[model samples]
Target: METAVASAASTGRAQTSRSRCRMSPKRYEAKLRLAEAFVRLVEAMPAERITVNMIAEASGKHRKTFYYHFADKEQLVVWLFRYDLASGLADKFPEDLLVREQDSPDNPLAEFPFYARRIEESGRIYNAPFFAALSYSLEKRRAYYRRIFSTRGPGTLDFYLHQLFFPAIKEDILFLIDREIGRQSAVERKALRERMTSNAGVDFLAEFYTGAFLSRFVERLNYTSARRTARDIIPFENVVHDSLAALIRQEIEKAAREPGSEDRPGKGGAPCASPA
Candidate 1:
């Protein structure tokens, strides 16, 4: 009896391990199909109009398969926004453009146009469908975000913004500031850090960048036209680069003035420091 029980336990463990396997190619492809289907449907109809059955049919998978993979439609929507869209952008955009190399002397923001030009030139990269989906999340989908922002939904608007739109922009901006201040004497660096991390300091950096740079960028990109999109690339790039640089300079200047309040960053690399 003891020997039989041991064998059965081993078999059960093996089955559990197999079920928990990391996403294989087949699994990833299925998820991608679902995400693409959701994106397509979202463009044609409001999110509230979309149904799980529609998504499953569009992806050519059964509704049960979707349930097996995702808990519900909301879960699927979050995954599409958080992982699928972010991953696609990361794959297409140059990751190195967002960070400063120790030896490079050029402005970090200067690299924005270089990559922006790539997306503009590639017919398929920032094409109509792609731009529609991206801009809608930032623009048309404001109502959905506002709802979650006001109350506790599965995720937060702040997170959706960070993961979807602000990842590279936030990283580069913070890195530029870090390098600039890092050269200062230890005393100045410490003082600046504290000032930037304080309450008054927090509002200056966070509100300016998110409200100014990010918000304006999305608003400008909301329009969809091939001719206008090409024309807007350089201007949009300038807006992004200039706004971030301006924000950094403003914060640095403020830090210089205020000895009491300094800025530390947030857990997810947001400009705002967490409240004490």
Candidate 2:
């Protein structure tokens, strides 16, 4: 009788273990479906418009299941940004022009091809929900700058702010170029080059080039309520890029000229003690 009782207990334990193992895959699959559904919903509508019911329906899961996997839609959105968007952009350094070799001379112009390629690739991936998720993440973080630097001291604040801002500006410029100019062939490239140089000054030329690229990119997105026109987006993107680049360059030059002028001190004429 004791043997039979032990056998039954073992059987029950084995069954419970198997059941837990089976549930793990199902749970994982459900979470993946929910994330995918969230992406689709955000693409169709803005982040604010997405509801729990909508996500549940889209994922083909019960409302309770969403709660089991995620606390709320906000948590899910945060997860998507932290995991999905970050994963996509992390290793994809635009190699063609953006990041030059350490030995290479400083050449901002070298980055143009990288920007063009990025825009082209962005257009190709425009249909993917990942791009929309990334865009949403960027939009959400726009206020992060103000929040992070608002209380910083002036000396540290200006330097920190530039470090924070320039990368975003550069990325935006690359997005514009990749979307618009990368796809153009030899002839089309020449025509676009001619058009850019026609009446625009040197400063305006960069803006025009970046603007044209971005406008084409936005047009390709076919966003339902896109605020800027194709013609306008490139120039606006360029202006932002140019302004940020100029500001950063100016700051770096000022630091080079007056290493210890500020509260900080360093050799190699670095503004701060450590190298950037």
Candidate 3:
């Protein structure tokens, strides 16, 4: 009986450990070191020219360890971009102001001050020379973004940007669409038909707008002079935000008026808009 009890306890412990998704502290630290090494390596050479072996060597970890943490180099790039951009913004900027309801009378694009302030603070976090001149890593960041955006295949800049920003705006977009759908009368619903699919396809509008904003923002960063202060470019951020908001609002309104657009549902249905 004692042996059986001990066996059962061991099995239970193994199962619990397998069920946990979190990484061990040591593993997390290893991954972080690998990521930092990747940034440094990319600065010296283009990301395409670098390999898994180079990263592992620079990080002082086994080459197999890179695969243990990430599926491929592209996945590492995704992690690097998020760490470089969103992680820095998380502390200083208010989460509530990041995204707004599509139907909200308040202009969604009016939060440039928040974005600008976050950029101003980002240099201190990443130790990148944002104000004086772009650091080596910052230069690499621009080059990588441009390369990914210009590529014809998968893993485009827009796809990655959508992934980066999707979480913050998801709830707000859902709420806006659900509220709008609920407001329609049964007759209106029939007039709208299945096109009212998934909050009237607001997500397509949001994702497209986010992608355009990210692509343009990256392109601007690539060409922007290093001497330009974050404050000096505040107006440009405002203009980009406003332009994205206006386009999104216009597309949403256009979808609402079109019957053909109504049949296509977003989020696991046939897309009403192009992913590109």
Off by more than 4 A, model 1: 1-27, 82-159, 162-174, 183-187, 211-214, 217-222, 227-238, 250-276
Residue lDDT tens for model 1, 220-249 = 533443323324454443454455545655
Please write out the lDDT profile of model 2 over residues 126-185, one tens digit for every residue. 212323333443344333312222333333322322222233333443344333433454
TM-score of 3: 0.50
lDDT scores of the candidates, listed in order: 0.44, 0.38, 0.45
Runs in model 3 deviating more than 4 A are 1-28, 94-140, 143-152, 156-158, 163-203, 225-233, 236-276
Structure candidate 2, residue pairs in collision: 115-178, 118-178, 119-178, 119-179, 120-178, 120-179, 211-234, 211-235, 215-230
Model 2 stretches with alpha carbons more than 4 Å out: 1-28, 39-54, 90-245, 252-276
**Distance from true location, Cα of 162 in model 1, Å:** 4.7
| Cα misplacement distance, residue 35 of candidate 2 (Å) | 3.1
Cα RMSDs of all predictions? 14.0, 20.3, 13.9
Please give, for residues 76-107, the per-residue lDDT of candidate 3 as tens digits: 76555544443333334355322211221332
What is the C-alpha RMSD, rounded to one decimal, of candidate 3? 13.9
Candidate number with greatest lDDT? 3
